[model samples]
Target chain A: MVTLEDARRIIAAAEKKAAEIGQPMNIAVVDGGGNLVAHVRMDGAWIGSIDISIKKAWTSRAFDITTQDLATHSQSGGQFFGIHASNEGKVMVFAGGIPLKKDGKVVGGIGVSGGSGEQDSTVAQAGEAAF
Target chain B: MVTLEDARRIIAAAEKKAAEIGQPMNIAVVDGGGNLVAHVRMDGAWIGSIDISIKKAWTSRAFDITTQDLATHSQSGGQFFGIHASNEGKVMVFAGGIPLKKDGKVVGGIGVSGGSGEQDSTVAQAGEAAF
Candidate 1:
């Protein structure tokens, strides 16, 4: 179970990184239970990125893998070629989602959107650092 | 729009109230767009309340009124007698949902479940106070 405090700190760190990069972003965090813990859309962030951010967090927590890895695995001729079609389309096989671990066990996940894949991943990495 | 911090504080307040009332609960918060912002299910909370709580928050934001008030309006032969059938069944006319307003504009909503209607309302009220 991730505390609300943990979620808040993660989002704050992610938001700071986004501002530093001169980008607005949508960020999401989910607890071990795969339930939303926190989510934010910075002023001027793309509205379309909201659900993407939340689903990225959920997908990471549900699969216990960073979305970058998932994307690689889901590539054509790879092990999870059609995984994106599952989970009501909530499985986002893309960068910017990372699981949060505590004592070597996944405790939550963080996701970011509204920027390039590398930028989003960078922001999500900042969020993960808070844990 | 309710920030992630706002949602976290609201959930914290709701959780505290639920603990004091000796009732485990599922709580959900949604932004002005009626998108999920945060959610939590305390240990031992009824699993059935998960979707109900989210929908309750959605209903509150969609209508800009408390779910309790919506219930009165949805009674048979009332002005909105069959309103529940609309919105893909996301409408929940109950006592546990409330809208969060800022500067007189409806900005978000919170919902609580897994207890009696009165108990759920009490917990939801605690969340509303966070804003």
Candidate 2:
């Protein structure tokens, strides 16, 4: 049962991290069932950040692994190519996404876009720390 | 030249961030042309997260604004009304997307899904950082 307050805290933490790094970002948080909880888009953040952020969360929840790992595979010409198109409108074969878990159970996910991939990942790492 | 390697690196960094945060998400990366450069879909992300993520990336590329901002407007009944469908399979009204830029020029976009709008955004933010 991920509540709005929890999502808010996560967003707040993510925002703080972005500010610390001097990077503009857009962040998002979701629940166990893959539902939205909270979101924040910093001023000057790129517009596409919104999609990348959500996909990160979705990828995390779906694979139960960090989106980065999947990204690696995709680039290596592993299963990502075919897999990306497998789910139709439900799967994105890029990067910048992660999943949220509690007690070894996926409860939700998070994603971010803006800045370089490294910078984007940093902010997401900060949000996860908040939890 | 944003090669496939660049996209791969961005994806890797974003995934690392996701793992550190312990969140599950679906992530996507695009080139300056809004064409998919790299992507990764986690094992179990929700079906809808994929669309949300891509939309985020598209939103960023198209409007030069974060998907979160567009989401706010869409929800608030702002100016973009009907603008979502205006693109004909190019624009998404939902959350989770961002654009990629190089040297102040829009190069491409990214998107994520499978989490709350907030979570999705967070993952995208991470990708942006990598740039």
Candidate 3:
């Protein structure tokens, strides 16, 4: 189970990394059920990204893959094209979302926003390390 | 005008109140534009309340009235009976939301869920007071 404590620990690690990189962020974590466990928007993070962050977390878990990978198949003429229109508009095909795994099994997900795709992915990876 | 710092302060106060009452809760804060600023779901709070809390905050700011009061006018046969069906289901006519006013003008809102109507409103009130 991805307990709330685990979510908090992950958020703290991500927050620290974002601080070190001098970027504010919106971070979210979801349990195996793809339900939100916790979320935070660091001061100065874009308010517009709040929804994107949560949707990205859900997309990562719902597909059991990093959103960057999903973006590949979700592009024009790709296998999962138009997937973003599914899930009532909750599917986010982009970077910055990574699935959380335990014992090599997908257990949850993390999403980060407020910077370039590479920056967001780096922060998300940092949070995953805390899992 | 509700910065992330303000949102955190509001959430902290609401969380404290929820804990004092022994009810884990979902809390959300929204800026004047009805955009989310931050949200948290206490360890054991219902996952379902996560969306509810966010919507409640938006609903309060959208109408500039406490959701408790809005609930009355939103009931069947009342003036705003179908308002909830509007806003793409983002409007919540409930008792857990209250507007955050700055110098008598609504500036933001706070929402609390995962308890009885009275409990939710009480917690939201504590958060609003912090602003």
Candidate 4:
């Protein structure tokens, strides 16, 4: 179980990376249960991405994989082709969400938005590295 | 505007109140735009109430009124009879939701669940008192 302190650390790391990249972001952190633990929307962050960020974190933790990887697997001919429609549109198969694992088990997830896919992925990676 | 710090403090206060009341809870905080700012589910908190808690906060901010008040207005023959049917059922008319006001403006909201309505409202008030 990821402690609240751990969630805070992950969010701080992600926020630092977002700042370094000059992109305001909405970041979400969710525990192993796919429940939100913490979230931060930086100044000037897009309001529309708030739910997306939360859902991205949820999707990452729910599937125990990075959303970027999920994006690839969810392609038209892939195993999870229609997975996006499964969770009432909460499944975000994109580049900004990453799972946080401890001892080979997913402990939590971090999701980032308000930037390009690459930028979002980079910031999410920075957050995942905290755990 | 409720800063990230304010959201954190609200959740923390709510958590403290829940602990004192011996109830594990799911708490949610939302900003002025009815966007989620932070959330926390204490260990042993019911997962079923996660979305409910969030929606409660959203409903509070969306209408600038407590869910308890909304419940009254939504009662049979009340001015808002059937108001619960609006917003795709995201409007939670209950006691756990309260708006956070600052400088005479609704700045955000806090929602709590996992206990009786009275307990939930008490914990939510502890959070709202933060601002």
Candidate 5:
């Protein structure tokens, strides 16, 4: 159910990690239904990453898979080639999204952007750990 | 959280109003997360109206304002002139959408289409009344 409070906590942890890496990032969380719960764009984060962050969160929960993994299959000639064109172009098939699980079941998702894929993934992982 | 039942009720009311006005219409509802909950297209409704209806619902909730009012600020040279280009084209700055409120706090939105802006606004208002 990813209550707003829970989203805030996750975002806090993600923000901290982004800070540790000296990357201003955009972070977003989505509930079980792949609906946005909360989002934050750290000071100095790229404004363009705002929508990407939210879409990445949705992509994570929409498929219950990290967008990093989704990217592999969404590339040219891959199993999910052209998947990024789906969901009104809201499927962000790249790094920085991780599904939140409770009792080993996906309940929500977190997404981070505004940095290199690895940096984004690191912050997203921090957020997932919070959940 | 605008439950499915609530969306159904709102759509039903909007449909009735559209019928009364002799206008087949497209109606949509979205929850607090700006995610679609329900939608309906009456017989003879414009197919193009379907997407508009859904986008209107999402826009209302996303900005916590009526799309009719959004239209005002979104006009050329207006305060939000280029805002429609934001939100990945999900922002519909026109009539036909209204924010749903509970205890003065926005909880969801309803959108209607398939007629003039005034007609759509009327139908949307009826849906809002139901909530």
Candidate 6:
């Protein structure tokens, strides 16, 4: 049972990390089951960020791995190449998503959109570290 | 480089299949990159069907697997549980989506919304068979 407070903290950490890297982003956090828990659309973020955030969160929850890891597989054309269509609005399979774990169990996930894929992923990684 | 013709044919086949089962549905077909190619909204379909259709199409394009495969894992609480947030309007992870393949290669996906999950999946599977 992950709390909303936990989701907020992760978002704050992710925002801070984006600022540090001079990137503005939209972020979304979801529980382990892929349900939306919290979301933030930053000023100057891209319109696509809203969808991207949700997708990133979905990807993290579905794969139980960082969005970056899925992106790696997506680029390599491996077993994950065509997996994105399976989840619909729930999977990004691209950069900028990370799963949040507590005590070795994935409790939630964080997603960042608006920046470049690399920058979004960096921000997401920062959020994961905060948890 | 898939065209609208391809999408329309798939939709017709899927709709025909739904009729065979006495299910009314909203169906969507999307290109390989998750872009909209064609869409059909049936009479008496649920309002949510539109979004669900898009999401299902998204899921197929993003995952490169039939929505049925994704639904199977979603039911089991596997790594795919939370990936739906990443693609926003594109991924469904439910039973109503199917990918379109040609010459054993994936080119697009079809999604049906409106019926029960099982019914929707059955119609989608029929569409796949048409192609």
Query: Taking the tens digit of each residue's C-alpha lDDT, what string does model 2 give over A18-83?
Result: 999998888988788776777788987755456556656766777777766665555334655445
Question: What is candidate 4's lDDT per residue for A1-131, written digit by digit as tens?
Answer: 87767877898999999999999899988888888876778877888888888889999999998999999989999989999999788999988999989889898888998888999999999998987
DockQ (model 4, Cα): 0.52
Candidate 2, chain A: TM-score against the reference: 0.89
Q: How high is the lDDT of residue B91 in model 5?
A: 90
Alpha-carbon local distance difference test for all models: 0.89, 0.67, 0.92, 0.88, 0.86, 0.74
Each prediction's DockQ against the real complex: 0.30, 0.06, 0.64, 0.52, 0.04, 0.14
Native-referenced Cα lDDT, model 4: 0.88
Which portions of model 5 miss their true places by more than 4 Å? B1-131
Residue B84 shift from truth in candidate 5, angstroms = 8.9
The candidate maximizing lDDT is 3
Error of 3 at A14 (Å): 1.9
Residue-wise C-alpha lDDT for candidate 4, range B2-98, written one tens digit per residue:
7777888898899999999999998988889888777777777887888888989999999999998889988889999888888998899888999
**RMSD of candidate 6 to the true fold?**
11.7
In terms of TM-score, how similar is model 4 to the real structure?
A: 0.90
lDDT of 3 at B15: 92
Q: Residues B23-67, candidate 2, lDDT per residue (tens digit)?
A: 667788776656677778776766666666665666677567677
Candidate 4: what's its TM-score on chain B?
Answer: 0.96
Instruction: Rank candidates by lDDT, best first.
Output: 3, 1, 4, 5, 6, 2
User: Which 10-residue window in model 5 chain A sums to the lowest lDDT?
Assistant: A35-44
lDDT measured at residue B12 in model 1 versus the true structure, 0 to 100 = 89
- Label model 3 with its docking quality class: medium
Give lDDT tens digits, candidate 5, residues A1-131.
Answer: 78756887898899899999999888888778776665666756776787788888989999999999999998999999998888899999999999999998999899899999999999999999998
Instruction: List A-chain TM-scores for all predictions.
Output: 0.98, 0.89, 0.98, 0.96, 0.98, 0.91
The CA lDDT at B113 in model 6 is 90
List ranges where model 4 is wrong by over 4 Å: A76-80
Restricted to chain B, the TM-score per model reads: 0.98, 0.84, 0.98, 0.96, 0.98, 0.88
What docking class should model 4 receive? medium
